[model samples]
Target: MGLRIPVKLKHNDKEVEVNALLNTGFETDEPVVALPLTIASQLNLTPGEKRFYLGPGALVGEVYLAGEVTITVKVGESERSIKAYAVIEPREEEIILSDRAIAELGIVVDLKHMKWWLV
Candidate 1:
């Protein structure tokens, strides 16, 4: 299993805590978090425009650029927030945290133990 961490996502006045996957392969220069349509809706985010993109393992897909939101990673008493661009797709079922997001949140993942801690 992959490393998953509790994260609180906020947009405007709406927010929700979810188990977000820490995907090291989801590389991007800027902080990005991929959310399902349901989460996007709950956050009151409207899908703005469509974009063609490449994903992990060189997979190709289309996703909606649902603007930006504040992503806060919560672990015990440590928490950090970063403004990230939200990628929403109809078929997405999990919140995928990009490599940039993880680094921005000061997350150090111990894949051997499947554990994570904030720095």
Candidate 2:
């Protein structure tokens, strides 16, 4: 039960907007972003969706940035830009911000204030 924030994903200069919950349980050094078949095709990306155990519920994830690209996090007043490790497959859902993303670009998730800060 955490907050779900609207996040944007960009590839090959195209952007897709989606919502994702702020999660600490997601373990990955690389950022995980999802893209649908249509978007992936637009960016010339072909990948597979991964199904794995996330706590108790099986979490299916999409991959992007396998070849290196840009990923940006846009919160209310703050925006952080970073490199994408990969995009998710079957991209029907939102994008999940990886810890590597937050740490690299100095993204501050102000849980108390309900705002994201960047410095």
Cα-based lDDT for every prediction: 0.90, 0.58
Q: Estimate each model's TM-score.
A: 0.93, 0.59
Instruction: Estimate candidate 1's alpha-carbon lDDT, on a 0 to 1 scale.
Output: 0.90
Residue pairs clashing in model 2 are 35-91, 62-87, 62-88, 62-89, 63-86, 63-87, 63-88, 64-86, 64-87, 65-86
Candidate 2 positional error at 98, Å = 1.4
Instruction: State the weakest 10-residue window (summed lDDT) of model 2.
Output: 60-69
What are the runs in model 2 whose C-alpha is more than 4 Å off?
A: 5-7, 34-44, 48-67, 74-79, 89-92
User: How many angstroms is residue 71 displaced in model 2 relative to the true structure, after the best TM-score fit?
Assistant: 1.3
Clash totals for all models, in order?
Answer: 0, 10
Q: List the residue pairs that clash in candidate 1.
A: none
65: Cα error in model 1, Å: 0.6
Per-residue CA lDDT of candidate 2, range 2-115, in tens?
556665666676666666555545556676544555655655666644544344467554343434456666656777777766554454554455566656767667777776
RMSD of each: 1.3, 4.1
Instruction: Name the candidate that leads on TM-score.
Output: 1
TM-score of 1: 0.93
Per-residue lDDT tens digits of candidate 1, residues 1-119?
A: 89888899999999998999999988889999999999999999888888988766788988899988999877677778999999897788999999999999999999999988989
